[model samples]
Target: MYVAVKGGERAIDNAHAWLAEERRGDKAVPELSVPQIREQMALAVNRVMAEGSLYDPDLAALAIKQARGDLIEAIFLIRAYRTTLPRFGGSNPIETETMTCDRRVSATFKDAPGGQVLGPTFDYTHRLLDFKLAADGDVDDAPLGTPHPDATPHIMSFLDQEDLIQSEPQGAETPADLTRTPLELPASRALRLQSLTRGDEGFILGMAYSTQRGYARNHAFVAELRIGAVAVEMDIPELGFAIEIGEITVTESETVNQFQGSKTQPPQFTRGYGLVFGMTERKAISMALVDRALRWKELGEDNVGAPAQDEEFVLYHSDNIQATGFLEHIKLPHYVDFQSELELIRKLRREAQENIMQEAAE
Candidate 1:
């Protein structure tokens, strides 16, 4: 039997007040604005929006402010707020093929179509802290080149033409929304993607690294990695047509893995796909690698019990909210359970002593 602990309402209220004061921190400093955070701390804003599954920069910025710069807490706040809004309907999937690419690169090919535009990336920067940036933090925007007007074709399509890569079939089926329903095993690619996009960045990175270290060695090559903006359109039932709603920046990564072929199938390379909100290349790439690893069963490849290959393991532990709540619950009072354990131990020790005394007397 267990007893519940109670009576902390007053303490809780006082603690919350103290927390709010600490969150503001030193009234002398100027308060941070949402727009400034949305603009200047763009990357952090992007992360919150990405994980929250919401596209509102203003709201994400506000969440960041309320969370006192804690990015994970900001994501949780955004996610909680998002649930209260009435969802009209699902939007049509944005066509990535028609993206206005700002950054595009290929690891397999030196000179890919669109001329390998490295619009903005930190790949070449020397890893040193700039004292000048710390002093004033003012830097001019880098010069831009004329973007290719045409929608850049995916690099994987070239291999697809030759039947040298696995093909993804177009379907009219509506995919499952993990947010609305409990997760079930043998998840579809759509559900898996949803889990990965909103998953903890560090966990996904670690899973991807495990594959590189030979846990499920797929020998992945970065087929293409792109960052760009795409228009979002939603259908109007009354009007009987879809119109452009808005645009959002995104990063997409495609990893080509080793060939999979048997007597029943042709020798063709398989692919892993990842698309994330905003310029999150590392997450996108990491997601792609983990995605491929998780598809071992679907691809008819043997599962050697790799952590990345376990769908239930990956999806179940991905959400930070669930993880945090369970971890924090250990701090709650467990006096009843502790007392039960203590009584059982005492009874077992007493029985042992009585048996020992009888044996000595004999």
Candidate 2:
């Protein structure tokens, strides 16, 4: 049992005051407004929103500001705030196929349908610091391109038509919400996808990287990586129809893994899918690789004892908020626990010394 210590209320209040003052930084400089953070530090906002499992950009920006740019802290704040929100209902499943593509690229095929549009990417740019941006953050307007008249088709469809890729049949059953319920083992693909989508980007990336480093390696080829705004619709009970509520930017990646053939099944290319909020290409791609690695059992492949293949390990430890909470709790007062440990160690030493003294006397 842990003992409750008192008398730190004044100290705690003073520390919070100091934190607020520190967050403000200087009186001379202008304060960073929520809008500026939402707009300028959009990627950070997106990450917080993704991990927090909340779609409010303003709240994420505010959380970032309140946390003094500490993303994990911002996520924690957003998550805590999220619990109080009332849920009206769930939205219709987003149709990524109809996304207005801002950026689309494929590593597997050259000149795939919906020609590669390198929209707002630093992939080709030299990794040099722009000294001009430091002094003055002004730039000329970027040239615009004509929007595609037709809905950009998914590249996987080409393989699907040929029956070259493993078919993923949609299930009618409603997927369990990880946020609402406790995670159970032997989780469905939908649950895994949900966990991975909101999982820590760094952790997901590391797991994906592990797969590439030959840990249960399934050679994955990026069939398509698309980033765009997708319309969100909600079914209205009164109207008896679904209406467009809003739009959200998302990054989707579909990776084609090496063909897996068994005596029963034909040699067919496998798939790894990832869909995430905002233009988080790296995270999306990483999620795809990890998602594919996790599908070894379903795909009729050997486990190979990979970390990514361990569903329990990946799902349980993926949430940064949970991980940080357990880790950070150690820093708090462990007086009772520590005292017990200290007393035990001292007792052991005394017993050993007494035994030594008895032996010497003998």
Candidate 3:
């Protein structure tokens, strides 16, 4: 019998110290400042903010620097920080129609009311490695987009007006925040959409692609993709009304999907929604498809056993923080259990051999 080795706390502390030192790298080289990281590693900061559900670029940059530019680690840091923040109140849902437009585009419609403004996106830029950026080149704003407080309505809204697509009523109730409480089974649309927004981009993309490949393919079309700043209003119960707390930049995607019509119900294009922090169109689009697939139960459609259709699968595996923590946890020590199994196997084999020898002699 092997004695159980039980020193984990000290070892963990040592490991953390070593990791911190490693993150700093060479002592001679000046440490990368948070501002430098915020400026230079803007994409990393953006990704961390997007995934972590926090928009502070400086804090996100600091998290990035501390994590040695490991975006996942940075995301973990930001999420941890976000958890600690005091929620003074909940914001009234931002009206996307009222957003000060930065970028708004639609693939399904050729011409929309707002005229599809493609603002501040790297979508069309060539994927060339710029070596000049390595020397810490300065970036300056090209031309500022004028704020349009009252922009034209969403293109999909026009389709709804014509009765081409299903019109969804905006609920007056506050949506549940997944971060505060344990995610229960049978999540709401708002909860599912929230999880998908912070979910790993690649995982959601793969799930979305799978749907397109005939795994519960619902025939989806991009209705609208909007990126802009929306006023965040918080309801002050004492004051008797909600006030604009602040403004946040967000990207929202609405995908129109084909739904089966019954004898009683008429055929109308159902919609999938995705609203995410920052200008992440790809993630938002993927999220919309996955969101649509998840709505199988609510829409009274047959479940195709798709990855997105499985609530347990989608909710459990979405966050990279949870996924990475569980994945990397396997690296911890498990020698005691392995040794016990090794001893049992050896004992069993020896006893079998002795019994066989005795039987042969008899």
Which model scores highest in lDDT? 2
lDDT of each candidate versus the true structure: 0.88, 0.91, 0.83
29-111: candidate 1 lDDT, tens digit per residue: 87779999999888888889888889889999999999999888899998899899998888999999898888888998887
Instruction: Kindly give the stretch of ten consecutive residues in candidate 1 with the minimal lDDT sum.
Output: 1-10
- Worst 10-residue lDDT window, candidate 2: 141-150
Candidate 2, residue 309: lDDT:
91
TM-score of 3: 0.88
Q: In model 2, how large is the Cα lDDT of residue 218?
A: 72
Q: List the residue pairs that clash in candidate 1.
A: none
lDDT per residue for candidate 3 within 1-362, as digits (tens), equals: 23445796798899999998998899999888999888766666767888898889889988888888889998999999998898776677788888887888888887777677888778898989867667766555578766556755877878778997766777678777788877887888888888888898888888888888888866799999888889899889899988887888888999998876644447888998888777678888999999989988777788878787898898789889999998987666667878888999999999999999999999
Scored against the true structure, residue 340 in model 2 reaches a CA lDDT of: 93
Q: Write the per-residue lDDT of candidate 2 for residues 1-362, one digit (tens) a residue.
A: 45666978888999999999999999899999999999999999999998899989999999999999999999999999999999999999999889888889999889898788778788999999978777756766778865344588999999999999999988897799888987888999999999998899999999999999999777899999998888999999999999999999899999999965865568999999999888788999999999999988777788899999999999889999999999988988889899999999999999999999999999
Where model 3 places Cα greater than 4 Å from the true spot, the runs are: 1-14, 27-30, 139-149, 351-362
- Report residue 176 deviation for candidate 3 (angstroms): 2.9
